[model samples]
Target: MTVPHRLSRRTFVGGALLGASALTGCSTVSRSTDVAAINKPAELPVYRRWKGAEPDLPTVNPLVPDAYLRYPRTTERAYSRKPGDGSEVKGSVAINTPIPPPPDRNRYWQELNARTNLNLGLTITPHADHTDKFQTQVAGDALGDIWTIPDRTPYLPQLLEAKAQDLTPYLSGRAILKYPFLASIPTDSWRGCVFSGRIFALPVPRGALSALALLVRADLFRERGVDPEFSTVDELMSVARSMSDDRNNRWAFASVPTSILCTMMGISNDWAEHGGKLTYFKETEEWLEVLDISRRMVREKLAHPDGITSYNGKAWFQSGAVSMMQDTYSALAGLYQQAKGDFEIGLPIVPGPDGAPAKPWYLNPNNAITGVSRAAPERIEMLLDFLNWCSAPIGTDEYTFRKYGIEGIHHTVKDGDPRMTAVGNSETGLGDFPIQYLTESPKPLYLPGFPDGTKEMYRNLKAVTPGMKPGPVHGLYSPTSSKKGELLGKFIDDTTNDVLLGRAKVSAWPETVRRWRRRGGDAMRAEYEQALEVKAG
Candidate 1:
């Protein structure tokens, strides 16, 4: 399945995520955020790993997912009974994959309903169309029994506070331990669900798995005799220059490596967190330096000559037109498949200017979060049970069924691993119907029939996650950010792009940033800083 952009601010925490202990110590220094008047850490779910199939490989970093070389031949029953109420359940969720076969004609859908004892119906919104669909519904107050809330929706915190159920009473602390699969989700992931001091949704955990990484061509590095171990930005750029050849119409980058450059420069993940204060990255001198470096890369032909216009960076990376591109760790599977033995991919950690291990900006630790609209306690409980059942981890009969579909009809084991059958390719899959977006287990480092890729991904995550940091303002509400939303966001984005593309002088940045601050950036910063001061637990 296609992944949404990793660095996009659009990736969101649940409207309100976590108690004090829920968020891991990253850039944010707000344990008090989870205290009473803000939230209660005791209200959060206790983390308990699901006892499932043993992994063939080890994951030292807790953020890195366990890797499996072979699919578990057997699955244990996670629950003894169906989670649904034998009644129709309707919901809406966004999908990045192609629309799957509809429930009426799909065997997998028919079986899922029978197994769950619910007539499940969902209006699947394509990622491209989701914003409009979600907003239209939100405006009309017509949210279904369940829905996936977009991170960028206008006044998200208010909408959730007004229309969504407070999941804290159900999922908080030891209370969550009853839902084995939900408890299995890392506690930090639940931090994304906290809004206004209460849990409002169930997060879709991606954690460090979704962090953006620099994908370099290892074969080319060896062939060109370029050293792959560089600890500073200048050293890395030297290598980039050595790897590029304008005369041959080749560059070291497919597109402007903005995200990678920002990481290397130690720019904070949107907002920099310091002693009881939060500073937006746009207000910093370091971000401007990154913009200048990006512009220089364009002028020196280190990046593609098209000047950052819409172009396929992955296509360039695959075709050898570019030696490096930035993508999430999840991209390796597709890259390996497309390469067809043509190249070896490398995951190199970029170091900061001071040679410190640069902190990669972690996505919200979740994608969209699933929220339940106001409903009877029984209906809500049933929905939660259904979600917890959906979270059945790898090596459970439910995970196997929901993730891959029925064995013979959808997938088959071949050469010691599961492979999708031709029928599985067209009639069923997550891209076609994104039930997983509602809530699924944290993804394992598993790619059917690509064991090496799985191993490599694990190594990659291990290499970088120790230095990764999350955006401090992620779950904190900023009324200015919500009210103005992307309208105000577009101004800053356009200004930043103009400077990066060399259309505007680097000196213009200060004025542009000032304009941003004057418009709403300053207010957002104030709001977030205030949020950090409030206690949660």
Candidate 2:
């Protein structure tokens, strides 16, 4: 249920402002004129203390998580053997869901290859064209000893010093005390799999509430009486023009909410800092007031002209045409299991304007990382023993058959939790063929039997985590933002979607922030302000 982090396919085709400029080019950077980053800030690794399972709420704040309300009646198997060595591994990832059941007619991939004797294979792919098939398999080095290194990969420390696998001599410092579930991760998610200083990839933790938001539908805003709270931006454009109609085709917005109007104009998630200097949210002014409020949500039609060429705005908000959109609050529990809950999706209240101060945009703890292929380097201890049985934890048994795959043929438990059986939803694709993409265990917010939809998505991400901000070069590393920051973020998302569809103007946003600071956002803010003064010495 909520230990998913399964967000790839550029977390829904790079929306939320192109995934906040690919998390500000994977956590801020420096030393450009041809890449250079790790001159410090790598000495991280040091987590390895196990003994897990005890949840039902008690994680308090490592930035809020541990919530679970069911499932864990009694379990405890952190690894007594079974990591693979019976030969035949192979991998690939990328997912985005819907394509499971293959590993040779998957019976949870043949009971996780006979409980780790091995013979896996995989390949997966499809996260909306997995970065052109992961850059044609990392430019033909043909990766696959375990893959998925996406953090908007481009030059990523010269593709981890040429095709991954440095894993700092088997998980650095105390050599990760011999893989007790990849040393139970959590050393601040191994600083996003460190690069220039070495650990070359493993983490995927991620948090600080980022499964993007805005969602809404709240039973059609309480049956159109409207007023699901608003405070400005002209009262949410007068509640999206009284929930627009477009001659009854319905269109209260299926896009152009541009990450909730850049959190109602507080905008600062991709590099924020003030007195000490650092700017970058497209050289802010609340990003030119969210490009003049996305050209007034497309000249007041209140959006949804296929929301500027759709890529599943939750299928135009589940065919009601559009009551609102801005996704990934973990695809709201499979769109509430394809609306068996008939309505109510939620996440509004992002208003702000009168006294101004809404903000919301903090995510970037670690998501998407799993390397290990530098041409096999002697299969790095069988890919760290299959990533220590895919970092088990979360009430184990190899995380309940690598995440719900065979109990009465792929899930059934019921009151003690489990669920997913309609032939395990036509065979393993819920949250796309799990094993939590390559390696997991350190993300928790449970949703088992939907504890009130996990307390209304963690009380709406803890009422926007006290105006979240997070990103002053998040984990730092900016070889010109891993080489031309996604081609200068698709040239600033095709010139801000051509000035929000008026086909360009708003004085083309300060010359598109002066061509994204003369291309490379002013040498990635002078290489993240000297990697934030060597991370404050």
Candidate 3:
């Protein structure tokens, strides 16, 4: 629904911690409540995998992506007809990477335009600046042909209704089969593109690849004869305590992992559905218990004192100052790339308290989506077709070219793997540009040279499928939430931190939550409930 502006590209790969209420978005000028329905597309675009090389590993859930260890030697094209109308396609995207060389100096950029048969006139904005950039454009109704947003706006449904294309007619049900690659996107992901009971965006699917997790330094844990496996939260805490050695300047965690702790204790990620009504997670008993649990951990000195302040969790994890930190599953590749030969990364399962099964929160099927501004029907078709061509799956020539570029020019092949050369990394800026956010294929459990890590990633992904839980409010829009959600979210997060570090007592959290409810939380619940009711009817 929305991308967090503060997260790095690595964080985006795994999933950004966009807080709880950052769901659907649109405009500032309020419109009538005619755009009130909350249902997703009725008949989703049916999934049909592109014919490609078979995955080396067995597929997990159909929801989980197939895994590949080696690149396909031979590839086929997905489009018989060219996507472009032999004209320029104007677009923009936000990135955490450095500004890349433009098409004139960047051969990779030039080739993409040439192959797609469209000259791309694009504007790139740093993620920090993207919120303002997008808002300015949205407010002006000047969004280019293609644009991806940074955060949920107050009136996303109204925004689209007024300025963006209504995609329901084009993408709903079997209508999308015309664009094979776009239709290949799973049904759950297609749901994210819906707002006001209509489709308004194209998904950038990540599936469960972005599930939040606790990462432990397996090499260190192994040295102490402790496997990072536990059947109970108590067992995990015991190990965390043993790993903390004040004299050695090592702690158990980089920070208090609220999401993991909440999962372990059975706290819902957003509103917990009750019959037909909804209750905000902060108002629940589980939240109170998790607050106490987190406070206890903080008091035990199991985390860095600076964890919430100036500390850099990634730097500390790399230096072994902390044995564990919370992150997304997609971080596995970067960890492998960094560990090299020094240490191994472990995904420690956060089992329930006293060994009850934990229903860990999973990310929405898509991280963020690309929306199109209003355009003539034919021009819109051209843009959609171009995105379809761009969305080619991993085993195709278009995919290979966009990701790694030509063998000698941008990358080198070694030991059955494609390696990006320095020139490729520099000119393409694949790691930095966040191009995938614009349009992407189903994610693969992939690590180019580290096939072993690829296998491990697959194993962990398959292992977590049974208990993964998605948010109830994923595709629904909440006017009060979008209007004041950020402010209220900050209030709760800051209060939680205060309690965790002894600045506020656990006894005060209920009162803090009560204040939150009055300030907008309660209003949000009513809005969501009303929307849900309208949808059901």
Winning candidate number (lDDT):
1
TM-score, predicted candidate 3 vs. hidden true structure: 0.90
Q: Rank the candidates by TM-score, best first.
A: 3, 1, 2
Q: Backbone collision count in every prediction?
A: 23, 3, 5
TM-score of each: 0.88, 0.34, 0.90
Stretches > 4 Å off in candidate 3: 1-43, 338-340, 353-357, 430-433, 467-469
Model 3 collision count: 5
Q: How close is candidate 1 to the true structure, as a TM-score?
A: 0.88
Scored by TM-score, the top model is 3
lDDT of 2 by residue, 210-308 (tens): 545677787888888897567777888888889888888888878776766766766656667775578866677777777887788788778777676
- Model 1 is weakest, by summed lDDT over 10 consecutive residues, at 11-20
Best-to-worst lDDT order = 1, 3, 2
- Kindly list the per-residue Cα lDDT of model 1 for residues 419-470, writing each as its tens digit: 6676776656532347788998988887766676676677767766785656
State the lDDT at 315 in candidate 3: 77
Please give the RMSD to the true structure for each candidate, in Å. Answer: 6.2, 18.8, 4.9
